[model samples]
Target chain A: MSKEWIGKTSNKVKNTVDRLLVKRFAESIGDLHPIFVDETYGEKSKYGVNIAPPTFPRVFDYGVLEGVDLPMKGLIHGEETYQYERPLLVGEEVYCYTIIQDYYERKGKSGDMGFVVIKRVGEDAKGNIIFTEIQNVIITEAVRKGINV
Target chain B: MKTMTEFKPGETLKVTLAPVSRLDLIKYAGASGDFNPIHTIDEEAKKAGLPGIIAHGMWTMGNLGKLFTPFLEKGFIKEYKVRFAGMVFLDDVLTLKAELAETSGNDLFFNVKAVKEKGQEVVKGSVHFRLYDAV
Candidate 1:
């Protein structure tokens, strides 16, 4: 993995937080939290409406970066972390983008592997950051082997 | 499940999810844009020396993340972090247990973990969140 990819930014993705989409995201995780599901419960709560889960941004479709491309076939999600400025509320349109934060290689018990650290940020219409996620992925030769197998 | 007002320091909450199935893996693949064969194709996984289709680490992390949902308001989580402690295979039943680590005025912190049958730990981390006053 070339560290040159570090600092490369991906295309931006925009989305309006739809209640149904939030519901679907929660359903996918089998989490039926009242604030994410029950409208009446939401009305009585602080936000006064449904909200998406912290990890819901995982569903945002961020197409591949223009100049930074890693082997897509054999990538493994190694670790993930998230920090939030505020909750992603239902009905607020959000814009998100990703950057290759860092890159490196290490030899592990499995074999030689490449690591790519990606930082994804989401901001509201006014440009106030709503959340940020840092995801690290590992690329292995076995990924290519599995494809041919 | 513990509420912001009701949760006391040192208390533990347990959340058990539905078994991780092939369908769940597929849906997650579609939803997360992580279509790695290791999570969806059995032959590829076996070729890679995996038992079969293994669940995504993020899926297990998401399972652990859900435990804090009921206790705090939306977007109140200041920070969340998790490490992939182990692999989860198809049909593995995951149990998540979270314990309150500390609490301040309106901030709540918890230590959470996900485990499979026989107490094999899969994921473990801490979540720091802020509580909002209910009107």
Candidate 2:
């Protein structure tokens, strides 16, 4: 595989947070926190409205992968990290962009493998970043065989 | 686990998560747009040489996030990171074992890890958070 994806960035994608989206995400993870799903509970909370789960931003569209095409079939999610400025609020709009932060190769028990690190940053309309998520993806040779030519 | 204000170093907060089911995986796939066959498709997972359908890494992470939701509601979590140490299969009972590593003024740092009933480590990470003093 070519190491040409380093530093590549995607176009900005817009996403809106709402009660249904927030509730569904919380339910999906079986986290039925009242702050996320109960309207009355949220109305009295400090955030003034229902809030999204901490990982709700994962559902945000970070545009398309502009670079680093790989056979995703065998891809492995190696790790993930998130830094938050504040908990995301329901009914807020956030714009996000994805970037290929780094790429490297190493030998593993399965043979040679490549690791790609991608980052996505979400910001409010005023351009203040609300949160950033970094994910590490591993691609193995066996998985590469499934890639379409 | 007691309130964050009373948290002490060497103290541990233990939480047993609900068993992760195939339906949960499907719901997560629909909500998160992950849709990875390794997470939702049994035959595709077998073809990939996996034991069976595995839960999405973020699903485990989100479960971990639940542990701190209370703290987040009262205080604030500045950062959270995790390394996917092992796979979580269907019907796995995950336990979150978190220990406070240190405390500096209002900042509390802790090391958190998740494991199955059989003691297989699934996720390991650390969290840094700040507590708000009541007025």
Candidate 3:
């Protein structure tokens, strides 16, 4: 039996909260919401600084797994869940830690495969949990002959 | 500011996502720890029966973030959920449309759908955002 690989990622460091980072992200994604780019416009709204979109966490959280390796092919994204404790603010230094929450294998139309769950928690400068996310990854063995797994 | 309670059901909004590239996929993979070869390697994607290197499902869902910009201070987004229905190849013009399905007090409910240029539904699901006083 192949041993299931499990591990944790290191913390990612962010020093200054650059509003431009948010703008660049929004622009790259073709987002035109004034709240994410125009600080003057955002100030007039509820959030004082430019508020990042919900998926913005994707830009910060994945850094935790900087140098890890899980050598396998044919990986599929099964699902994702994110919960926010508070809205992230600009200029707030934050860090994140990632861990393998669970792993299991089963037989399906795809074939005998394994699923790995990863969780990452984001914290503020004060060490408060601001957000948490979990990602499910499916790994399947290589198919043989013309038979599809 | 308009509260979700003010909008009726079946109201739809069209939102588009910018073009994605191989570099963007690599950047997202580094940030999300989802180094799935299908998204980063064209060869792998071809072998998997995909047109080419494709974007991540979350990356596509991230387009919905634009909709919430108009309604910030609503406590950010509380929850966003979706299911991957199809593949999004590189350089594909993607559009996300959401219909206001229901609303209660400060919370707005939406049945979200994403599609490629060919009008194929790539993802479908619901998302809920909490609204706050506009002031």
Candidate 4:
């Protein structure tokens, strides 16, 4: 079936890199890279500023609806792809808009399920596109007894 | 014994992951839209059989970016893949170590592993990066 959902989130005014936030994000992922925390080390890098790690964008909660509700269970992460228009620098206010780009139903080995594609675009203060992330999530009903998909 | 090939395995790099807090996990949930209670709510996580709110797999993968930046200057990571193994509990220290696996032409590949304080491997994966010469 051809179905699509679209949603938008406004810009968030962030004056700095939010060390505590970035640090926590890094820590959760078991990251030990000093550039994320050491300002001096980051300053010497090619970016000349504390650059948020590549997956840093995933930390923003834009609240996009992809025809699904919050706390979606049994949601398996199928694939993820990222495209960067420009490098992200610290202390820049940014915003992201998420949309349900596409969806389809398929018959798997177990049974039938649906696949959803979510797209999120992050933009800077000047409305320049910084990056775009596309994630595919598979939604299926929990097995009645002892089947796995 | 010298092998026929001219490839050499790069040095190994180790990084220690510090303890993670609950607040940190919440932020990651927001940023990633992965509101799986197993990662955000401790009570639910415990009920679900996980020791505590576990970190997102992608978040762990992101850490590798720092390791590669020094080698591939002005290089954008074209792709990365990882396979999840064990669970990561809150406040548990983790470690990520990598060794140059091999090189194909100008592409550099590294085999990386993430483990917990107990020495349990949480994830094992490989990353490929494209290198560009300075202008």
Candidate 5:
């Protein structure tokens, strides 16, 4: 029953940075830039092709953590980050996966709270990193108890 | 919001958005593939012991990028990190701000934040951008 939850990585999940996904994401955040939607403008622009927004990669599948189970409900997204080597070009293929970077518990106002730091990476076909994200989630006492963590 | 080399360390950019709505969360969920009920259904949120449906933390963080939208031609966001200080409920009007923290060659550091109408800082952190054409 030892829950050593660091460095647990997921299998790579392949995804395409398509136009529709990028457009929806751009519009959803209410930051619809021409580079994310208008093809004509994008073609004439610096990149010569439509490019996804900086934060668009948040939508890609980063696979799942193996042998770790936690309640999805009652968990708070405490912090998040996105570090990009470059923006993912539209229609480009990316492989993503997640790693449990660290896990610990702390005393909070409501009681015991658990902090889970997960690092998700997106790489190109050559295995070069395009971006990496570290997501910090706050799990409630009940969630910790449920998982016996 | 100065472009190119005109940006200085103390320069700042601000964008005040409309109130957060149920549809905003719903749209964000669909676009981001995060279907957690606590973000969309009020009943589900109550069952989860929340006041009501809360906005996804990423939703608010994503909107913070708006402060740099006009300056894209000059650079791109190389890093964005933030802590969710408070929950975002419906009808919360968020004010996004970015102040150039420093400059190093082509890289520009910015202290970014989002504040609720009531003056609560919901999200706060820094962003790093690399200019395409730098001096």
Candidate 6:
């Protein structure tokens, strides 16, 4: 068990909330909401700037934590949650990093399963917290065995 | 736009998504930076022990947020949560539903979910949002 990772935090990754990045994410989800795509609409809206969709941060990369042995191929995204201080504004620089919140194992029909809880945090240039996303990743017994963890 | 007072608790909203395709998944991979092969190439999916390529769980969850797009001006989504109940495969048509769960002051709480054509829930959760006036 990679219990040592429970308190590990990854290095921060900087992301510019660019317009095109927001637009592409909106399009991929089939949501063409003007607030996310139309700059003019965004300019006139309450936000005064285009905002990324609520789930947009899923795209941001949180730099890797060294020595983590989990395999990426078979891990399942079991659950997700996002807590926002406010919507991410377009063009604002966001620095994000991930922390391993917890880890536990359970028995399942197929085999033993390990659940990893990770919290990814984003902050503004001043380092004020912007949003926090907590996601649960599941590793099946086979994948764990392959890694010999 | 429906004002916070105008929306009654238990009011439900629904959005039916077009069947998901491989092209859509490919585009999502490019946009979201999650290029895990199980969500794209069939061969890679097979190697991962899946029957075939499956859609990214984020793709489906992202679409579920669409149920509240119309309310963006009223308020932004302060919180969105979901549990991935099952895998979403290519060409699977999904239906998203959200029912107003409660209202307090400017905050609106909703119970949301995503279901496939066969009525299987692929994702289900809740959304918490507050009105702009309350900000």
TM-score of each model, paired residue for residue: 0.88, 0.94, 0.77, 0.64, 0.96, 0.96
- Candidate of highest TM-score: 6
Instruction: Flag clash pairs in model 6.
Output: none
Ranking by lDDT: 6, 5, 2, 1, 3, 4
Cα DockQ of the candidate 4 complex:
0.27
Can you write out model 3's per-residue Cα lDDT over B1-135, one digit (the tens) per residue? Answer: 554446677877777766667777776676555677888998888998887888888777777555656556555577777777887878887788888887776667788888888889887877776665432
Off by over 4 Å in 2: A145-149
Per-residue lDDT tens digits for candidate 5, residues B1-135, read 346478888888888989999999999999999999999998999998889998888988889987777666667889998999998999999999999989999999999999998899999999998888857
What TM value does the first chain of each candidate achieve? 0.88, 0.92, 0.78, 0.77, 0.94, 0.97
Kept native contacts, fraction for each prediction: 0.63, 0.72, 0.49, 0.30, 0.75, 0.82
Worst 10 residues of 1 chain A by lDDT: A140-149
**Runs in model 5 lying further than 4 Å from the true structure:** A1-3
Give the alpha carbon lDDT tens digit for every residue of A1-149 in model 1: 36778899887788777787788777767787888878898888888887888788887755568866566555777788999988888888898888999888788888777778999988887888889899888878575354331
CA error at residue A27 for candidate 4, angstroms: 3.2
Better of 1 and 2 by lDDT: 2
Instruction: List clashing residue pairs in candidate 5.
Output: none
B1-135: candidate 1 lDDT, tens digit per residue:
435667788888887878889988887777666788899999999976778889988778876888777665532888888878789998899999988998887777899899998899888888987766542
lDDT of 2 by residue, A1-149 (tens): 44677888888988999788788899888788898889998899988888887788888888887645766577888988899888888888999999899888888998878788989999999999999999998888676555521
Task: Please tell me which predicted candidate would have the highest DockQ against the true structure.
Answer: 6
Q: After superposition, how far is residue A79 of candidate 1 from its true place, in Å?
A: 1.0
lDDT of 1: 0.80
> Which residue pairs collide, candidate 1?
A87-B75
DockQ of candidate 2 is: 0.77
DockQ, in order, for the candidates?
0.65, 0.77, 0.43, 0.27, 0.79, 0.86
Candidate 4 lDDT by residue in tens digits, B28-106:
6765556778888878878766667787767666764556544433454544555666666778777888777877765
Local accuracy of candidate 4 as per-residue lDDT tens digits, A107-142: 888677667777877777677778777877766645
